[model samples]
Target: MAIDWKGVFPAVTTKFGEDDQLDFPLFEKNLQFQLDAGVNGIILGGTLGESSVLSLEEKGTLVKFAVEKVAGKVPVILNIAEGATRDAIELARLAEEWGAKGLMMLPPMRYKSDHRETVEYFRATAKSTSLPIMIYNNPVDYKIEVTLEMFAELADLENIQAVKESTRDLTNVTRMRNLFGDRFKILCGVDTIAMEQLLMGADGWVAGLVCAFPAETVAIYKLTKTGRLAEALEIYRWFMPLLELDIHPKLVQYIKLAEERAGVGSEAVRAPRLTLIGEERERLISLIDGAIAKRPVLPEYHSIVV
Candidate 1:
């Protein structure tokens, strides 16, 4: 199936309870909310979803739940980014069987410097399933960059259909667009750089902040595509302050907190991950409130909980 890899695809948050257990019910509610808000797809287990912290079982359950809840309304792309090729392949196969539309694999973090090792890791994982694979190339998180040459090599693999170019490099996005032509789809992975990337010829955006403000993100994307830059910039300015949170170390926590403020989900997160609290929490709330105040009217789907 040719997935329409466009519009707002939110890197969803994994809701947790006070006991640090996955809140499946809350997760489903959150998923439903994003879909209702008109997201094109749901990216489960991505960085924003805190994929690294989830156990294999938790990953499987969440993928299954997201697929079931979406029910053909939107594509569910599972992040099968394991440190080893074997585990990634296994998870890829599992996700395919669980009804995921595609797989998003990141570079193996174990071998930081070897580009060949990273290439082999992705090749082996792609070989395990026929599902289309989207490379998650975020050098900031992985510490290893997938160069244009490496991306060119991966593009030859039939199932390697798309890339989530997280590095905020417009030149590289243009290079990929030049090299691959239409063979590979490039989706902007950085929320703050999305409009520029799109203008530079990126096919779609895999946004994290869209979890809180799907309507605006989707609007910006659509408007830019239609050459409505002046109107889009108006929304972009309001989004810029909130987009700053995407660069923070505790982004997942911040996004979940924003979701809570928007009444979409809880702010609770698993251990090793801390929720925003005290003055820091107050600052975030104020920022969000300020963003809300600047807008003439909030998206109809959003309701302020605090």
Candidate 2:
């Protein structure tokens, strides 16, 4: 399947069992919600999905299950965040073999590579896979910014097609549009800045909080892209407080909490990362509860299938 690489693609959360195994049934339940909400694509094992803690076998199971369950309704994309170029390449091949239609790849983990090295890493991964890649450019959390210069070096790699622009510099959207033009498709990566980025010409959204609020997320993107700023802002205003959670250190737990509140999934996180507790738990619950209390009756929003 040729990925359109445009529209809201949720970086879905990985649901886990009591033993911390891949909770396939619960995971599929969340995926069905995204698909029914009309997400353009589904990203498995990204930051929101807790890719770092998952074993290769667990990830493979997720890829195969999502590929089978999604059954081509939309492309199933696996995230690649390996620490080495060779490992990334190996996983890219494995993703293809596991029936993924595309990949959302990050730069080397732990070691922040320089510009030249970053370019080489992306290029090598691109070389190793026939599947299209969306470069995850999240300098905020990852500490490795895939700047325009690095992108220029990677311009010729035909398969290196899109960027999940999460630099948090709003001007970078305009900068990317001006510099790269259509050389790369731009998917807005930050949740809070998503509407602004779309207004600035992002082709899609690689969303985080959308895992919990799929309908509202789709509504905002659809409204913004169609020039309904007033309507979009109305929903955005209601969504802003919850959207802020996506930028926090414990976003996975926060989002999963929101998911449970939204009646989609469990707040069960893996070891070393417990569900929200104490004041932190109350704080998040307050945000989700407040939003739900005054939630907007969203306007009609069908996926803009490109």
* Top candidate by lDDT: 2
What would the per-residue lDDT of candidate 2 be over residues 176-269, giving only the tens digit for each residue?
8899899899999999899999998999999988988899999888888888889999999989999999999999999999999998888999
| Candidate 2 residue-wise lDDT at 164 | 96
Give the residue spans of candidate 1 off by over 4 A.
296-306
Best by TM-score: 2
lDDT of 1 by residue, 154-224 (tens): 77689998889987787988888778788888899998899999889888889988888878887778777
For candidate 2, the lDDT comes to 0.91
How accurate locally, in lDDT, is each candidate? 0.83, 0.91
List residue ranges in candidate 2 displaced over 4 A.
303-306
RMSD of each: 3.8, 1.2
